[model samples]
Target: MALLVPPRSRTGGIVALVAHPDDESLIAGGTLALAARAGVPTGILTLTRGELGPIGDPRLATPATLGEVRERELAEAATHLGAGWARCLHHPDGELPWVDVETAAAEVAAVLAPLAPAALLTFAPDGLYWHPDHIAAREIALRAAALAGPGGPCVYEACWEPETACALVAAAAARGLPASLWGLEPEAFGSPTDGLPLTRVDVSEVIDRKLRALRAHRTQIDRGHLFATLPDDLGTAHLGVEQWHVAGGPGPDVLGALLGEAVRV
Candidate 1:
């Protein structure tokens, strides 16, 4: 029989597994920041250095500079989120989807076994944006979560509900900001039925950290344009809220319900 525990009692230790450097910011930075603020040990596992990313400065995208630049950016951003450790897998960008899941899972398992976080976070099916690498990362994380075994870490997937996204776009438009590319098109938003069943994670507390982290990827995203195009209030109303599909395991909402500290939507 499963042992009972008090609500939000299991505290400390959380991990985020993603395909690229900036993915942590776009997808799960708020949750990361929340974990850090709670004094929980948080780890980030980046599958690639994002060498394939196209940037305003073409030179920054080259083989030699890309890795170093992205690594630095990732480190700085992770620091802003109060992340404890950041590990790079160095898989070639755009090529990760083709990597063997078992092999990838084994590598992830090795790291996770030692850290022993209470939860593991990752991408959902359709990859949030349908990027090939993102999809592969999801597969790898799912396998890794399984390999992590019972009492290891509960798994979670990033997800944006259709109704919520629509409301967000309306709010953005009211604030004179361009609707999110995906929000503008139903097809781009991906399948509604694909997300796993779980609780939504509110992230109002560390929204600024997420913004700061996103700004650190200057080559990929124009900070000035982001601020000018999307005002803080509007951005907060939209991005400050994030959701997750928790994979029930030995623990229920070990990270979200416990250390997450925000109301669920």
Candidate 2:
């Protein structure tokens, strides 16, 4: 594995496409924060406002208003991560696969045309935990990246390092943490079997920022949730490094240049 060296010149910016409001924060917030701290303009486009997600508090939002509430929460999270902007598409939650791919691709392309981020981050084909919306978002993002042509942004998928993820899951289980809180069942918590090249970005410095961004999505995350309950040392051990697998675009690895120090893992 070769270290991904940072680019010599800043090109455009970084844009993350996600299926729901908190996906950006949960999946790649630290990376976004790191990029922002490095003076790289960063943004996020959530395909849906996560209207179907379980509400943490009824007082915060009702069914009819959950979409709006989540949208606002996403914005706050993005701001906390130092993102330049955050936008949402009104696709129905849990039904993104039903959306017309061409239409979704066009909408995504439209968003990318203006910003032209050097790197486009989104879920892997497996959708991390095999969420339908995540899969759909990844498909749409890939289509949009293709539409962007030769000079388009490099596409990267948020990924987990298998051994490390398994260890974390075991540790969490040992602590009596509920799988539901982390959105994973004990049997389901591990990296995919397919071995893909990975880039690991050390985000220890921005872990606090990432936690704040996660907390900002109060509508989805409960006070006693796994994210909030993890001891600081465990959190650092599990979340300090964000991992990405190149999904599309040119070169073996281009993010190191676009963001900051990154190494092959």
Pick the TM-score winner. Answer: 2
Clashes of 1: 0
For the record, the alpha-carbon RMSD of candidate 2 to the native fold, in angstroms, is: 6.0
Candidate 2 per-residue C-alpha lDDT over 199-237 given as tens digits, one digit per residue, 9 for 90 to 100? 888888888888889888888777557665555566678
Model 1, poorest ten-residue lDDT window? 1-10
Give lDDT: candidate 1, residue 243.
75
Clashes of each: 0, 3
lDDT of each: 0.72, 0.79
Please give the range of 10 consecutive residues that has the lowest summed lDDT in model 2: 1-10
